[model samples]
Target: MREHPRDPRAAVIEERIASRPQGSWFTDPDPLKAEGDVRAVIDAARAQGAMPVLVTYAVHHRDCSGHSTGDLTAYHDWIEGFARGI
Candidate 1:
């Protein structure tokens, strides 16, 4: 049987990626829940000595293929809640 060799650089790259600050995506349909979740993420990031980066992807007709699609009015409300979280 042949032994498989692993690239030592892969571990270093993975560690670097894990050490970096990551952004959180808010895709919940419920505005209230999204608000609370965003706030929690922000708080957690702050506690970790990192700034929060958020991604809002709940807009109506997102991607134009029915993926993450929602009503415009609801999207507006969701954005409002997301803002409140910040």
Candidate 2:
């Protein structure tokens, strides 16, 4: 998994997970910082010879009546940023 700035366990979890010889899954949970985050994760994965899988979770009305709702414009920009990162 990618290291998220807001996740308290990000560093520890990433260190443990990154040691495995497997792909890394990155999620764009924060629109404001997702671009840089994605880029960093991709770079790190590539350095380790692992494929990076990006999981975009921000979308308009995501999760239906549950949490994770986002604005359409924001999602659009987020997606653009995500592509740029790749």
Candidate 3:
């Protein structure tokens, strides 16, 4: 991991694995699974007497430039779905 500074996923997985003693960990690989993932996290946090914070991701067309990007309508839809999830 020291040799892969730009690999955020690897860093997150490594941290999760190392923090096993602190709590159980879960990962959602599907980018389209945000709604369900957010709900799951919120439920888990509530169960532990914690408040959850959700940060949304890409809404428009992505992958063209190796980043999350989207147009106004797509982004608006994403935001709406996120709101529904909450």
Candidate 4:
């Protein structure tokens, strides 16, 4: 992990649902729809010499969706990494 510092080039992205932490069931595979799209996002970033600090999140629950304090906390860190990398 890299140390945090202020920079305009940085970016942060996050998704959260409010009981479980992020990626409680994060599969290794990317979402089907996201597969191609994410590559494109990465390609665009690379084309411009931008750093890609990628992180994915998933919340585990009885159903397909749920969240907890841990999820939000994870979201914060993921976004921070993304932003710092940028």
| Each prediction's TM-score versus the true structure | 0.71, 0.60, 0.49, 0.32
Better of 3 and 4 by lDDT: 3
Q: Which tens-of-lDDT digit does each residue in 8-55 have in candidate 1?
A: 677777789888877788888788988899999989988989888899
* Residue 13 accuracy (lDDT) in model 4: 20
What overall lDDT, based on C-alpha atoms, would model 4 receive against the true structure? 0.42
Q: Which is the better candidate, 1 or 2, if ranked by TM-score?
A: 1
**Clashing pairs for predicted structure model 2, backbone only:** none
Which residue window of length 10 is worst by lDDT in model 4? 18-27
Model 2: how far residue 21 lies from native, Å: 7.5
Ranking by TM-score: 1, 2, 3, 4
* Candidate 2, 1-86: lDDT as tens digits: 34468788888887997677653344555555777877888998789797877776555576766676767787788778777777
Query: How many clashing residue pairs appear in each of the predictions shown?
Result: 0, 0, 1, 4
lDDT values, one for every candidate: 0.82, 0.71, 0.58, 0.42
What is the TM-score (0 to 1) of candidate 1?
0.71
What's the residue-level lDDT of 66 in candidate 1? 68
- State, as a TM-score between 0 and 1, how close model 2 is to the true structure: 0.60
- How do all the candidates rank in terms of lDDT, highest first? 1, 2, 3, 4
For residue 22, give model 1's deviation from the true position in Å: 1.9
